[model samples]
Target: MLKQTLQQKLLQKLSPQQIQFIKLLQVPTVSLDTRIKEELEENPALEDGSLANMNEPIEDYPDKDPDEQFNSEESSFDEEFSVDEYIQEDDYKDYGGNYNGDDDEERKEIPIAIQDSFFEKLQNQLDLLALSDKNYLIGQQIIGSLDDDGYLRRPIPSLVDDLSFSQNTFVEESEVEDMLKVIQEFDPPGIGARDLQECLLIQLKKKDQENPTIVLATRVVEDYLEEFTKKHYDKIEKQLGVNSEELKDIINEILKLNPKPGDSGAVAGKQLHVIPDFHISNNDGVLHLTLNGRNAPELRVSKSYQEMFEHYEKVEKSDKKMKEAVQFVKQKLDSAKWFIDAIKQRQQTLLKTMNAIMEYQYEYFLTGDDRVLKPMILKDIADRIDMDISTVSRVANSKYVQTEFGTFLLKSFFSEAIQTDSGEEVSNKEVKKILEECIANEDKRKPLADEKLTEILKDKGYSIARRTVAKYREAMNIPVARLRKEL
Candidate 1:
């Protein structure tokens, strides 16, 4: 048995409007339109249109208090209300949405590949065989099992089981293997290899086998693959009795093989362009920041919806159906206002957060130099913008910025601090940039090791450890010295 007790406590629960604002804030410029379209379809009160009033001046919509929170409970129809009391008089500014940017290509341009899907082409190629219905179904099942890389990774037993249960046909593994061998001969040279080695061999088998280089290359791939991948040229030479020049040609031929056969020969497919969430420009040493809002559709309360709400409110409070209609209209209106306000808050927060980041990385953005990036973290921007670190992270994580040098993810600019010998604070990005340069300029025959890299950084006044150097190298996708070596 439990005893009743009185207690005082505090709890924090996200309101629906607050949750919507958080979600909208985190959405990048690329997905804003889809999200807005979803809301438009879900709520008839919301519609895409010009939020900018041509008749009213901009000053008439006074800047809303960013700190103010939206509360849906406050809009309950059961409570006493007036026509002017519920109307929010939407405060969203159309920044390059429907009100502007009539020519910005709608924030993205994904070139649609006018061709068959990967599996479809493979299926078409499979159809040419004209196998029996059972064999064709088995082949179709096999084709469906292949991954995007064109590799059939599933075990033979698994395929047999799938076909037995799904196709109502029981077949042995040999039949499936025969069909696979037939489909592997399709176009693209390496359509049905099971692994990297198999993929390479399939491609090379399609090539001229009579060439001396081809013969030697097949030997290397088939026998000395381990040593060859490890760049153990000494062991390969000792075993194969080949000189450095001949070995180089052999290694080059094997290197040209496509490891992932599936990526190649897409008949037609979509290539999505990187739609930057923000744009930073250097105008004669001064920096300017602008949010890419071409995909942000304009949204507001429907005028007819508002009129319907008013007409229902004025008629009567006694009729049950009329009151229900009033309640429904009020709910829709509240939802519309909440979404509009959330969008406005999203814009404000994006601008606020990005402006803080731009100002924080002002020096680097000015000249597109990684060395000039100041040591910054989520907390720094959060403090600068008077927001939480989580909010700042949401802004930085999925966002991209277009710069003079190139498009960069916002997360790239943030790095931990490293104090120099001179007792001055510097960004780890600076050290990484220097580390990248050293590797880029080093001799590939004997690339610099992490210890040597650490010493070089220490010589330059960065007290980074060998482990830290390795971490940076790995972060930049650079391999170890042994892997970087070449003949």
Candidate 2:
């Protein structure tokens, strides 16, 4: 069934240069400096320097006369040729200048990159455990299994099977239990526990005094976890033989304990300063926007490399080695030019897209009110900016804007449209705002149920189902009516 056929089709595809431009467009000002440093390291033709000549306009280099250039295909020798001489390191040094002394005097301060992770912290603690080599390995394995929240969700039997199969080392369940008990005593007391009950109990057992509230909380977690989660206060009361006030006190104590103990120091360890990508301000009746300018340093192709390229172009063609060198220089110069051009295009695209977004959602920005936000999506922004939906999405993701009200992720302004009973279109975010207000004003003794909440919204002109109400409630981290009940 083999066949040969000639086919032709027209398609729109991004070149490597174009793709690089799009990626750069999505990177906000906060990350631009690091990105530029990475590029400088990768491409030798590109250099980090403060050259006055860098600001000069780039003109196309003239092509050399073909008669003088070497015909490489006609050559017979297999000897190697180098293009390094064409690129004079002196040119680079001149532009960057022999300012080592000047640099030292000026003291250009480069910010140190800080990096830490949850795993590294846990590994440090694992190192301190005074266990046998084999037991230490087991302890490390257990620590590795913990999730971001520091809970060990895996079962002992499953871990044992994995260890035996993967590492070819058979470990007994009893050995794992013994090692786990020691690990639970680590700085984050609840770490390496199998379940919520075990996690809470491990933390409580570490306390100096056996407080009555602590003991009661431990008992509830160990024995009445199911009832507690289900908000079955009547059943818990009968089972624990405690009054409502006593039970509330015990529940509050449990709430104060960290559910994910490993998340304590680990969270602060990796905390990054919030750098808003965009700043929004109001002047008179007009909204003003400015991209954060601190992190992004001005960049361009090193002037020395451009001069080297110009020098290579005037060389004679009969020298085959020299022609090859010229070709190499040309390629590097092209790459450098493409990168600088791409960066310029990236800045333009970002500014254009964001400007359109601000204008589109002007009401929200001006009033500093969520209710003023319209139902907007990626496609709406794409349409406004005359770009693709995917392009708009890339700009929105991982980008933040600072407003008079607060700092928010760029994507937070976008929400799906919900039709009200009066045939008016509103954002789901607006409905959530109303729901939050209703809850905040509601009497805690008899908090509204999902069905009742749905009816309340319907009365207020929003047509929503009980399930949708429940979904929104859960999204806001609000508990059910029973869970919200207080003494």
Candidate 3:
């Protein structure tokens, strides 16, 4: 049997404008222009630059009660609709006049120099090989199987299967393995190895035959790669019958080889350019922050679209086509207004959040010194700006600021507070700096261990734990003490 019951539940949903705001807030200065161009294409009512008075300040539209605007029926477009509801005389105030007239800035696009990609380089080498058409196709298939790190991650059987089904060619695993050997002999020295050990061995074996150290280096990679990686030099020396000095020479030869051979060749026009979103300038002792506006083009609602809506209002309400036209115009106009308002709001919010950040880390900005960076979090900036933490995070992500010293991601300034032995709270960044300096100055033959690093920091009044020091070291991409060892 089925029973019916009345249930009450509360639901929270984002409004269309709210959703639009969130998406816009996350777009960095480099990509904001692209987003704006997309909006312009989708909404014909939106226009670039000011069409009204240059001195007028542009005001946001849809100033009416939202409950009324959203709840109203489409039929009301014919009866109660008025163009004035969408556009007010005061809406065309600040036009951001600098973006207007012949003063519009033009940027030149420089042609990128073409270069071969990793796969193309591999294929070029494969082409030089004298093989039958079937073998040639098999070789091409092998090249396709290599990952970005220059390793053949796929199994040989899988390549054989791929050739059987996809290429309509039957081939044995032995033939694929044969061709794989040919590829592994390519210019990169380790272009098609199966693993790290093989990659190193391939490069080591490719060295000049006259070099005596190659034999020992090959043995170390082949027999005791684990010991070599763990820095157990004594064990490797005893097992290989090589003294400490001889082991050092062989180790030096191994270290000279490229681990990721595929990375050597340049790919055509694949370089990514980083554009910082904010600029910080220091004048004497004060810091000034300015948002990068190169990508954010000035925009406004099209005057023709506004006039068309007004014209539709004068048409007969009894005509269904005319009523439909009015509704369409109204929707486009509303979208244009919402989009424009969103862009302006995004600008204001970004400025507000970045200004708060610049003020909070004023000392660091003035000196470009990481040590002076105060302890701060998303909540702290959010509290200062009177905005949500998510808003601050959105600004921090994918955004970089160009300082007088260097460019930095906004998240770099934020750190957890660390309590010193003196009971004073400081940024964990300070502790990390001290730990880094200690590691840099340590003897490579017997590197400072994490326990010693912790003790050093403690002596300096940092009061950091070994585990925390390890975490910090790892965060900076520093290896453990054992891995840091060298001859």
Q: After superposing candidate 3, which stretches have Cα over 4 Å from the reference?
A: 1-10, 50-55, 60-110, 240-245, 265-268
Candidate 1 residues 293-384, lDDT tens each?
Answer: 65345666887899999898789689898889988888888888778777877777777888998988888888888899999999999878
Arranged by TM-score, best first: 3, 1, 2
* Model 3 residue 87 CA deviation in Å: 24
What would the TM-scores of all predictions be? Answer: 0.86, 0.77, 0.87
Point out the worst 10-residue segment of candidate 1 by lDDT.
56-65
The per-prediction tally of clashing pairs is 2, 2, 7
Off by over 4 Å in 1: 51-111, 130-134, 161-172, 265-268, 293-298
Q: Itemize residue pairs with steric clashes in candidate 3.
A: 56-93, 56-94, 57-93, 57-94, 58-93, 58-94, 115-268
| Residue 31 C-alpha lDDT in model 1 | 63
List, residue by residue over 1-487, the lDDT tens digit for candidate 2. Answer: 9999999998443344444556666666556665666667767788654544465664432221111223457333333234343233212211111111222245454454564567777788888767787787788788888887888888999878878877777899999888887777777678877777888888878764468878878888888988887778778888989998998888787777887776765665343545687889989869999877643345667667788878988877689998998777766666677667666666556667789889989999999888878999998988777677877787798678898889988899899999998899999999899899889888987888889889999999998899999999999999998988765
Count of clashes in candidate 1: 2
Backbone clashes in candidate 2 total 2
Count backbone clashes in candidate 3.
7
Clashing pairs in 1: 113-269, 115-268
Q: Mind giving the per-residue lDDT tens digits that candidate 3 earns over 1-487? A: 9999999998443445555566777776666666665677678898877444545476753322111224434222333333344334213222211221123358544567777888998899888888999999999998888888788999999999999999999999999998888899998789889999989988887787577788888888999999998999989989989888999999998888888887766344665556788899988887888888753467878889999999889888799988998888888888787777777777777778889999999989988877888999999998887777887888897689999899998989899999988999999998888778888998999999999998888888988778889999999999999999988
Q: Against the correct fold, how does model 2 do in TM-score?
A: 0.77
Question: lDDT per model, in order?
Answer: 0.79, 0.74, 0.79
